[model samples]
Target: MNDPRSPAQDPDSGSGLADWTAGAADWIARADRIAAISRPATEILLARLDPQPGQRILDVASGAGDPAFSIAERVGSAGSVLATDGVAEMVTALEGRARERGLTNVQAQVVSAESLAFTPGRFDGASCRFGAMFFDDAARTFGAMATAVRSGGRLAALVWSCDDRNPYFTVVTAALDAVGADPVEVARTVFELDDPEEVLAACRGGGWVDARVEAVGFPWRLPDTRPETLIDTQSELSRKLRKRMEGLSADQIERARGIVAERVGQLEAAIQDGDDLIMPAECLALSGRAP
Candidate 1:
């Protein structure tokens, strides 16, 4: 998992605290959209975790609260979910969302995955959605998660499978490349653990038993949206993309948008239904039980 990009250029380098903190506002603004796009993966993780009613759960790196909120509903008022993120701003946003939804069972905290401060065996289950890949040390984070969950407690995580299987990433990278943008360096980190074995190893190293990996494929659908909207949302959500875009001229930005639109139209897995767009996405779900 050695990042090829220099620390100065890597958005995910170190703890990625700064990058995530800075992007909190944007993520909060697009929370609903992000949740919609990642709903399938969330569902898969939730199923794997199999959280039971009256059981406490831990959700790590819960940036606008996805499965956290969903888990709260599943656990009901009698149970609870501790949703955490390294960035305080993200926790604030998560708290606001929880309050807005009247999810009294959900609690938001600024806690990093690598340094979870919860007592040992405090939770019945733990889940991390699209967060394992960004962890500075996946095994360490998993180890912390293991410590938080009771023995035999379930643990599940979702991560991008590969660049090839996920057109949502490739299309954007292709468009950026077509416009002479250096997206390759920034985007490659997304698939650092593309191999299922890598996830299994991390789980085992962190004291998780019966670790297993599964490939989950689903359509990332956006109803009443166009390719341009997707590109715009990506630019705003991706810190590196936004920084790169800052240097581009107005004409170059427009060109990149057009390229993205064209590429989206040509994707084999992309389906156009009325004004809606569906792009194929694949992720690896790693599951195990605390030892």
Candidate 2:
């Protein structure tokens, strides 16, 4: 029996959800830039969802309005898409993006995954990308999502398969190590939990019935090979990390720079005579029905 309570209230929580809420606010101000980097993968996931007209969809942790706005297009004027996140900044950005797109079908709200205010069986379907893993209790968090959908409604979320499968973090970490930064000493705050069994168990614990997990593999391309890219990569984590790193010694900083430079050179070599620097990213797409 999972308690349906807001996970955000837990201060000592080990889950990175709290930090993500704050960090995402900062990220949304630069939403267009972030959206460009992740747009391809978002398109792939939405294509699979194929939301239909008249369907009421929920875009949980809808950062920067990409997924929600995308859903709005599919649902059209009759249907609606509720875009939500625990961070107010994200909600503000989402609303701004919706307004800019002239999308009246989308609404933004500040909501947490561990607890949702919507009535049970309220939604036709729901989807989240790279969001569920941040919960303090993944099982409790997903259980809430399950309760929000109608009996026949669908739920889907995307998470990393494992650390090694994604170069965005692994390559950058390797770069930090190349310049003499201790691997173990590096900020583990941006923790990525990708165990298939753990994820499945969480979904089941959340009252999801007949949940299915699919692997989505695609190339993640970064346009630039500069030190700025390294900073952007770190931004993908959290500001807490950025703040912590800001205190590092000049020599240590230089080492980190060298590591990133080496990784960039490798990526440049891997580029296939084109502007796109595609690197592989493996995602686990989990879908299930509400009981």
Candidate 3:
């Protein structure tokens, strides 16, 4: 079973930074695949943020620069986006991607969400996608974001809804359990902020007013239905699961891998898709206004 601690108490918040730093290169390599899967949620967040031309936007925990780059395009040359991540490696990757795309309007920086050291009201809008749930101090981080935005500016965040509603996460947990490997630690942190009300309360506590939550669901479509592809992709994407597998013996690891393959095979048989597997994913999009 997973732990029942609140988001603030979970140690993964700190470890998650280290994990992301170590996996930065892998994430960069798979950035396009991830971006495609997360585009729907990004659209939801952008709609809530309501960014406009000639405006400055702040993207906190901007991993591989998905919405940041998207926002940069939306804002055009007249506006700018400051993409900040706590991990320097992530920032470096983001910079590389921005440069490759010739995005002069997007700037990457190594800034922690809890310690956003920008001038007061420096941004017209801010966003954080799939990053809020891993925050060590949600209220403090959100408050810092609020401080950086002007009055009435919007703040939008996207977080995972729950384990059951997210097949991408549950599949791995089920695989681990099937092989008798403990998945409690990984499961605990991934869904820490699954509750929408908790996100609303945190935003309100951080001085963001008129906070509301919306549910966003999308299909995480993969081009291949192969079990090996699923296992390899999930292993690369989930740092906690990868780290856990690293501690297991070769036989134990093989057992878990086999379980994942079996489960994925079953899914393939049930779905009967010719070349693709579409996993259902759900996220909570929270929007609020700065005080």
Q: Evaluated with TM-score, which candidate comes out highest? A: 1
Q: lDDT of model 1 at residue 291?
A: 91
* Tens digits of lDDT, candidate 1, 86-191: 7777777788889999999998777767677679999999999988887778898999999989999999899999888987777766777777875423322778
Model 3 stretches astray by more than 4 angstroms: 1-15, 182-188, 226-229, 243-273
What would the per-residue lDDT of candidate 3 be over residues 140-165, giving only the tens digit for each residue? Answer: 88888889899999998988998877
**Angstrom error at residue 36, model 2:** 1.6
TM-score of 3: 0.84
Itemize residue pairs with steric clashes in candidate 1.
none
Model 2 misplaced regions, further than 4 Å? 1-15, 177-191, 226-241, 248-254, 261-273
Q: Which candidate, 1 or 2, would have the higher TM-score against the true structure?
A: 1
TM-score of each: 0.89, 0.82, 0.84
Worst 10 residues of 1 by lDDT: 1-10
Q: Highest lDDT: which candidate?
A: 1
In what order do the candidates fall by TM-score, top score first?
1, 3, 2
True lDDT of residue 120, candidate 3: 82
lDDT of 2 at 249: 75
